[model samples]
Every structure is written in structure tokens, then in C-alpha cells.
Target chain A: MRIILVGSDKLTYFLGRRFTSKGDYLTIITPEEEAAVDLSRRLKATVIAGDGSDPTVLQEAGAYQADVLLALTDRDQDNLIACQIAQDRYGVPQTVAIVNDPDNKAIFEELGVSVAFSATEIIGSMIEQQTASEEIRNLVPVAGSGVTMTEVVLGPNSPAIGRAIKDLDLQGAVVACVVRRGRVLIAKRRSYLHEADRLLVISEDDQYGQAQKVLTGEGA
Target chain B: MVSNLIGGNSSASKYIVVIGCGRLGSLLAGRLSAEGNSVVVIDQKESAFENLSSEFSGFQIVGDASEMATLKKAKLDKADCLLVVTREDNVNLMVAQIGRIFFETPVVLARVFDPAREAIYREFDIDTISPTQLSADSFMQKLNTHQVSTSAPTEGVA
Candidate 1:
């Protein structure tokens, strides 16, 4: 996937690194030359020094062909404007914006922009998960929201992985997505899971323990 | 000779270097400096110092804290503590990890934006603060206290 990220800050750089490592083409746009230079060097992604809110800059960065455009600038207005330009002018299929101000998240969503409240929702969910259980490795909300989906990579000794999804007996959780050796498999009852395969599960707040037990095979 | 050595050591105050001088970094530096501990701040952006306390009497360097050269320049090995308060949680984590794992600094604290990433930071066994979660809780508290005023008058008032 071709991903264009606006801003060269730490979050943008982190995402750029993650996406680039996954074989996704990434281009980062930053107004500051130092940020662009630093992030470009760190992530080894194409860094364009220009105003992300400008259409000309977006064109130069190949925003039109981008599969996903992330407007992650520090300023909320800049992110919104960038998202608008990417969606409206460039005709990008998927555009996600980071809403620094949680209050403006609704406005961005209303405009049909996928919004990630990094400072609020993302961190809030993680804090909730941390308080819930220690076994949760990394909890990333897919598509940046809803259903509270998380990816859990089973440990080597985990008892649940060898067992089929149905045999794991997940009481209140549903496996939504699974990734085995770069192959994405939608969760199914018949899916015979493996030890190293990454699993994406969605469950209620109360069911987190059961979900963790099923994922980690702690109970088994 | 013993009296001269004791007098010389008593005059030297403990110094701390804070890397990634953002909001939390600046705050910690300011607080520590105010308490008479010598402080030095290092940040990639030179403009970040604008928010720093004027009363803080400390050296400020504009450079990446992750770089070994920068760390050496900041005197990490000699500093009593290294505080990593960059906005990027990863950078802060890396800085803290290096301070603890490499330099074996006595104290290392990092600012972590994602509370979920705390486990990873804990694996490194360094202190961490999640500013984002605190901000969210503050917002939630404000929302709970928010009151809506209706057009209707009170029972005793017109």
C-alpha cells in the first residue's frame, strides 16, 4: 500500500517506520527541513519538505496514487485541511487524520474523514488494556476505532495456539482477524491457529480476561 | 588535604540532563533547577526553549538525544539522572533504555504517550509517565462537571 504521511514528528515517523517495514510505500511531508531530514533518515521513507495542506505539495508527494493518506500534523486545522485536500482533490480512497484536540474529532468524522484521536482514544484504550491485564502485548484499534479490536501474537508456550479457534472456547470474545506469515486470514471457527500467528480479537471490557486467557492459553 | 577535598566536593551540586525538552521535559527541568540541582536540557528543536522557565539556570543544547555524540556532549555518564521527555514515546523509551542499559544511569524517566506502550517501557525497567492518558482523564473530568443552563427561571427567581 502507498501511504502518505503528513508531518515528520515522532508519531508520523513511527507509523512511517512500521508501514515501510511492512513493505508499504511511504512518503512523509513536513514543513520543517530538520524534521524532514531527521525522519527521512530514520524511517528511510521518501520525505518531501513542503506544506502538507497545500495541494501542490500533495501532488509532488504522489498523494493521488496513495492508498492511505495520514494527516498527522500537530495542528488540528492543518490535519483537517490536508485530509480534505487528499479526499476531495486527490480522490484518495482512505484518509486518516490525527485529531490532537478530541473535541474536533466529531467534526472530522462528520466530514467523512477517518480520525484517530491519538492523544485521547488511542492512549485511553491502551491505558485501559494495561490496567486490565499484563499479558496484552500490543493493542492497536484497527481502522483507528470501534469494536475495540486488538492484535495479539501468541507466545511460544501458549496453549491456545495449537488448538482450533473453536476448541479454545473463547467465552465472550470473537477473533476478527488473523495474520500468519504475512497472510491475512479472517477469523473463523474452523481456523486452526498456530503458535506464532498474530490474532486480532474483539471483546467487551468485561471479557478482556477471557480473551487474554484464550489468546495466551494461560487457563489451558 | 582531607579538609581541602571535603570543601571542594561540598561546593559541587548534582547535575541532571533532561533530553527532549518538550512540556514535561521543561517542567521537570524547571522544577529540579528551582530546587538548586544543576540541570542541562537537550532538544532537537532550538525553539522548544521558549517555553522553559526563565529562572532555570541551566545549559540548553539543541541536538538529538538519541545520538551517542549528543549524549556524550550532554555528559550522560556524569549526570545524576537523565529524563527523556520527548513527545515521541518511542524516542523517549529508546533514550531511557540507552541510559539504563548502556550507561547504567542511576535514574531514568521517560514520557510515554500511549499507556499501552507502558509494558514495553516496563520491560526496560525505567520510570514512565503517560501524558496522553492524563490529558484524557482531565478532559473527561471537565466533561463530567460541565453544566447546561436552561432558559427556565429558578423556583424563587423571576
Candidate 2:
């Protein structure tokens, strides 16, 4: 996959390394020449030293051929601009932006950034998840839809442990996949769950808590 | 044109929503409110709103203008005029576009820093004032007048 990364932050470095290590064609646009030089030395990636928000910089970064454009700039403005320019001018298939302010997530979505995520919100959610009674961790979301993909770890004494996948009163929820003792399997309708089994469910925003409740019902 | 219609006395007081509480947004919100228009000013940082005059009677929302939920919370759908004056030209353009596209606001104005953003605004049929262009024009005007005045004789200007 041809990927264009903008910004020289640690997140940018991490993503660039991941993509480059996979041998996915990666082009990084960093404003600082020193950072670009440092990154290019470490990874087999093309580097464009300039503002990613600039059309010329994006053009030099092979934006037209990029499958995904990640705007990881620390500045919300730059991220917004880079994503917009990428989508508008380059027609990049996917554009993701890292927003500092959580409120800008919705705004960025309105502004047409394919995915806008905030580190603060993610951290807050992780902290909230840690404090919560159930050990339900959010997995990847189902692509463009509002439906969320979540993994629920069934505690030893949970309600649905002994039940079949179809037996759980999921209420419009579907078990996409299941992981048992690190073994992955397709969730058959009659597939049974065991204690410590992880079930990945595709559910809407409002259905998440109910799904959690059904999976992690009354017990320690 | 739309701004003029909204500002005229023939119409009822227009609902104005100003995104960003920077010097320009704060002053504009205060002035618009003082002129009997209903104004709501939004900013992510609460401290930025201290720039507004104490006499300002408009509402204030502490939130990001780019977020649709924040706009809904600010009741921006009812705005007759919207002003986006965020520090970043990109943010201002996005917010202004939201005002134009989502809310169908009668008049949407944006404060843009980069002169290149004027084309984006024009593409969206939104109005924008770029400080760079304004400054350049003002500087050129001043330069021309300065040269003319300096070259002219004291009493009999050529």
C-alpha cells in the first residue's frame, strides 16, 4: 500500500516504522529537514521536507498514488488542512487526522477527514475502561458505519459462559468472531462460549452497554 | 449581500454565532450583541473569552466550533450570520463550511490567514477575509499615498 505520512511526531515515527517495516511503500512529509533526515536513515521510506498542508508538498510526497494519508501533525490546523488537501486535491482513498482537541473530532468528520481521532479521548476512554467493572476493551470499529466492533472478555462466573452464541439475547447484535485461549474461530450460531472466552461483537453505540451487560452479567 | 440583509433594520434582530473568542471574534460578538443582535460566541479555552467586554450580553459556549455536536449545542442552526475567526485558517474554513453547508446560514464569514484559502472559500460559496490580502492591499495603498505626498511640494501638491 502506498502510504503518505505527515508530521514528525513520535506517532508519525511509530506509524512510519510500522508501514515501512511491512514493506508498504511509505512517503513521509516532515517540516523539519533534520527530522526527515533522521527518519529516512532509520526506515526505507521516501521523505518530503516541507509543510504537509501545502499542495506542492503533498504532490512531492506522491499523494496521487497514496492509498492512505495520515495527518499526524501536533497542530490541529495542519492536520485538518493536510487531510482536506489530500482528499480534495489528491483524491486519496483514506485520510486520517490526529486531533489534539476531542471536540475537533466531530468537526473534522464534518470537514470530511475519513477518520479523526484524539489522543486525549483515547486515553480518557482507556482510563474509564480500566475503572469500569467489566473488562470490555474497544476493538477496531466496523469501517465507515456507526457500528462499533468490541471485544468482551467473559469472566469465569459470567452469565453467557455456558450458553451458545445464538442463545444470548443479543438484541440485534452479531458475534463476528471469537477468541478462546488465544485461538481464533469463526463464531458459528451454535458455538458455545467458555469462561475467559473473548467475543468480538459488532454493535451500534447504544447497544454496547447492553451487550456488555449480557456478557458480563451479575457476578464478581 | 446576505450580511447586509441580516443587519438591516427592516428585519428582526439576527442571530449571530461567532466561533472562536480571540480578539477579533470577541470584539465582533460584543459589538454585534450591543447593536441588539442575538450573538453566541464559542471557544475551546475559557480564558480566551476574557477578551470580550464585560458589557457584552451575548451567550458564550466553551467548546470547539468544528464539532457538529458543539454547533448543535450552540444552536448554530438558528444563526442568521456566522463568523469563524479561529487562529488557524484551516479551522476557520472548516467551521465556516459547516455553517454554510450544514446550517445553511444566511451569511458565513471566515478569517483566513493564508491568501490561498480564498479559493477554497470561493469554491464553497462562502465569504472570507484574508488578513494577508488585506494587509498587502493596505500596505500598497499606503505606499502609493506616501510616495505621492512625499514627492509633492509643501503647499502646492503636484
Best by lDDT: 2
Calculate model 1's interface RMSD in Å. 16.4
Instruction: Give the DockQ-based CAPRI class for model 2.
Output: acceptable
Off by over 4 Å in 2: A31-34, A48-50, A60-67, A74-77, A98-110, A114-220, B1-5, B148-158
Candidate 2 shows a clash count of: 1
- Candidate 1 regions exceeding 4 Å error are A1-220, B1-13, B140-158
Per-residue lDDT for A178 in model 1? Answer: 86
Model 2 clash pairs are: A107-B66
Q: At residue A32, what lDDT does model 2 achieve?
A: 95
Model 1 TM-score is 0.37
Q: Indicate the residue-level lDDT of A69 in model 2.
A: 94
Residue A215, candidate 1: Cα error in Å is: 70
**Best model number under DockQ:** 2
